[model samples]
Target chain A: MEATDRNNREGLKAWLNPSRYGAERISYWLQRLTGVGLLGYFIGHVYETSSLTQGPDAWAAMLELTQTPMGHMILLLVIGMSTFHSANGIRLIFTEGGKGLGKPGRPDYPYDAVSLNYRQKSGIWIALILAAAAMLFGASVLFGGE
Target chain B: MSETIEKLERLDKKRKEHEKKEIERSSIYLKIFRANRATGEQAHYDTVEVPVQRSTTVLDALLYAKGYKDHSIGIRYSCRMASCGSCGMKINGIPRLACYTKVSELYGDTITCEPLSNFPHIRDLATDFTQFFEHHKDMQPYIQNENADIKDPSKLSEFVQSPEDVDKFLQFSYCIKCGCCYSACPTVAMDTKFPGPQALAQAYRYFADSRDAATEERLELVDDRHGIFRCHFAGSCSTVCPKGVDPALGIQLLKGHMLGYSSNEKKIADLKERLMRK
Candidate 1:
């Protein structure tokens, strides 16, 4: 049993690389997806604003098009991805600052004095809910009781 | 003459009692597992028994075994006082200087010594430090000042630094580069690209040095995935350092520097929160 426990500990140690490759891989993909989406949104937003150069009539027409079903769905996806990416980024910052999820003796958190993982997890849930709310609000604002 | 002789006899007996002190002086038998390079296999153990004195260091006993019993039993030593840093090997499964460790510290009559882990063994105890030093050189461990006007033989005054600044990097400069910490570091063991704590700490030492001008250039080199970010702060490097230089602290400080304004803003917010709580 002692040998089994020792082997388990060693196995965990071997997996927990200082480079944090597992977490990093997750962060990398999330960042890439969010970045592309955000970039596309910015470009489209700028093009829509460029409708002002056409006339105030064209500008209002561009704003009216944003109230469509596809526009609402894209905005929701953007908000969800961006909020997740940013929240996880902040969590990464806290992870290095000695904040992590789980109990003290848990293999994931070997030396956490205060529980950060739960808080960060809670923050993620809150951020997601808030993002969903914001997307709904944004759609409503654009549509205006339509 | 007779009285003087009696006094001398009393002194001799007293001296013997004090030095010997009735401590259990037993023979500690060591079975060292060495990898023979010639055959490319694990070498058989050659057990050597040496009298364990109270103050007798492991290096002293190894030397005694080499000198008296078996001349072929390989071991390395220089500066028997632990200053030379050559006698670093695994003493009972931990990397330490043989010169500094007493034989009595071992729990049992038999203790093992082996070459440092994850390094090519040159002999029974000596692992080649060439790769370690090569990595050190790869970090560009010197001041790279772009300022051409600062050069003058006499005009170069003592680089005025604060007491706090001097205190910060003082411990890092004491690194003997014994490769004990490097051997113990898990990052260096797994990844070839990730520069180990010794080199990273050395990089931090120069980076923190007020006189060094090329901060961004040096930071840029080690700012990547396999660089300073690779340090998970396992803290084995700090534990094994003979000089007590905390490479873990240095690595964390370097991480703090790399993260920059976001962390600083968080710190400010945390401070404000603390003040409000107070």
Candidate 2:
């Protein structure tokens, strides 16, 4: 009974957390957040690539800066979010483009017409796998896991 | 004095003869939903027994109840025909002109009368129209075409329109602004951003007009989330529209135009979706 009570208390705490509403709100915010994340990453990538214009020394300095523990972690986080956002966007593009996410046969129907189905589920699974792989690769280079 | 007495006797005889021939009518209970906004109290219904004859309209019943039974019942009525656009209310869960709805057609002893939906209630069966009419005013619902300066009929000439071109917008042009469709719209109930069915229908009326210079500009107004996309096409607005203007069709047509699809192609897509879902 005590153990059961402890489990119930933890459940209650989880429900009461501020992030409870945050999770539910994510689906609607997913597109906007992903757009912002991708734009930021693209800008940063362009700046880093521009270093090659200066000399090899500038390029090496930028690379070494990204090799630090905190820098490496930030890069991994950005890549992970970008992959998730991109996959979800692809799922939406199919939906908005009238490819069936809900109804299987009628691929050209509007997003609202077909109820969301396994195609979207597949998109989500694929995104998660790609993000995990990126994270693993990112950690390996930084931590000597390679 | 003798002439007045003789006249009174003749009128009495006529009254007696008319009573003998007069058909006995039934009395009905009108259940009206009343809300007091001053107190910030919610709506509640009160049933009033009204004496109604076969020829009596719903407006007649309301007037009878107000004049004889209770004077506090609030109602706005003028030009009792459907032309005036006043006396609009929800009769039996549908927005209808009280002057036009016959009392004999209503089933059950109790007929529910309430204000039009999607507006703030002022009193029993009366709604605040400031918001409803403001939507139309925002659109600048007048012709802004090149021909606005052409006053002379002979100089201007009629805009050459075939029967088909005229028919597309003819149905939408008959809006009385009675707000029957606006009240009955479920989408309007959910979101205020959605420029309700009436406004969208009006927008399309001008957008389809050949002479209207601001078609593209008007389309931009209704192209956003709060504009045409909010309509789920429940078809209730079309059902309740007194003038037979199908705002549902207008909204669907507007949506098709906004989505970059031909009307016929979108219709086929809708049909295909329906079949696939089943």
Candidate 3:
């Protein structure tokens, strides 16, 4: 079927474009993307572990994949993504559940919404800092260790 | 004396040049998005040159284009002030009201004007708001008092509320229905069933209102999986709101009440009607 411009919605483009908005909006889809990525890694890890049923020969072959340089890099990324995903998810539980966000009041001029202010935005910064620290530690363990 | 006069002449020339730069009058091209569904015309941009001052708004430039350049250009506006909530569009990819946003506030030599996303496009820079209004209607924006009947025969009854009580819902009440928040919402872009920010905020406004009854039905209305739950609280809704109506806060607070985290109990303001026996 041919297409039409009738429904010209921004679709997922709107979700991906963080440059258009502020911290909270950017972290929203970043959190979701990392979550999906971690899930994929989790499934791959399970499949890799399933090789244990075939004894040392099969397990050793599967372990070879992780012993590769690419595998180490991916593992390091997973460590960071997982850390961020969990930390931000915990923050969202309180935010989406309607705590920490201040009660609505008169929005005086130069209107600052309590949701977009530093209190909520600071949570996003904390999550990023946690992710970076976790990734640094993972790099040391994966690459710097004997 | 002649050397001093010459120095003053040079300074005056410099002062005049400085004053000219201070006013900052320049011409900017408004690359307006043009669409024609009736003629099945594919969407495109038509660049129009508009002389602008520091005080010129997006609405002013668009009006100039329509007034002199092209009479066929489609644009919607009522009150030139921000109160009408008519002229809203995506100026440089951000959903904002054309009337309220001064051209000086925007950073660009070429301004791009497009119809708001998440709404069905009607024509150039104009989108269909029927569905948006319908979603708003579904929320039952007006007062839904159960005991609205007049119990007495002679005097009038006024639902008197304190300033503290008014503060709860007063912020959300300022929605101009401009749909800037709706356009800014990423969830609204993808999820059609989600009631969007405008409607959900109105729901919280009335639900939080001290005089309003019918809390159970209001809660049930926005309690669907596609309803309040769809809002991930990305907060683009709150950020894009031109009138300071924080729809994101309203939705989250509503979620709080829905999830039993916050108190749903409203004192149901005391009726100040005359109870005098004639």
**How would you order the candidates by TM-score, starting with the best?**
3, 1, 2
Write one digit per residue (lDDT tens) for candidate 3, span B1-278: 99779967876776566445543548888999998876788889999999999889999999999999999999999998999889999999999999987776776688899999988888898888988999999999988664455554344357788898899999998999998999999988888778999999999999998888878899999989889889998899888888889898999989988887886657322222222321
lDDT of 3 at B188: 88
Task: Give the interface RMSD values of the models in order.
Answer: 14.7, 19.4, 6.3
- Error in Å for residue B239 of model 2: 0.8
CAPRI level of candidate 2: incorrect
The residue-by-residue lDDT of candidate 1 on B74-109, one tens digit each, is 777778876778888878766788887778766777
Could you give the candidate ranking by DockQ, starting with the highest? Answer: 3, 1, 2
Q: Which candidate would rank higher by DockQ, 1 or 3?
A: 3
Candidate 2, B210: how far from true, in Å? 1.9
- Show where candidate 2 strays beyond 4 Å: A1-146, B1-25, B39-42, B150-158, B263-278
DockQ of candidates 1 onward, in order?
0.02, 0.01, 0.48
Clashes of each: 2, 1, 0
Winner on TM-score between 1 and 3 is 3
Error of 2 at B1 (Å): 67
Chain B TM-scores per candidate, in order, are: 0.79, 0.79, 0.85
Give one digit per residue, the lDDT tens place, for model 2 in B1-278: 99779967876776576446544459989998877665555778889999888778899999998999889898988988777678899898667889977787677788899887667666777777777788887666776666665676555645666666666677778778888877766556656656788888888777666556676788788878677776644445655666666665666666656676434432454489799999
Query: Could you estimate the TM-score for every candidate?
Result: 0.57, 0.55, 0.89
Report the alpha-carbon TM-score of model 1 versus the true structure: 0.57
**For model 3, how does the per-residue alpha-carbon lDDT over A1-146 read when each residue is reduced to its tens digit?**
11245686788888888778788888998897898899999999999999999999999999999988899999988998999999898888888878999878877555667777776778888999999999998888889968
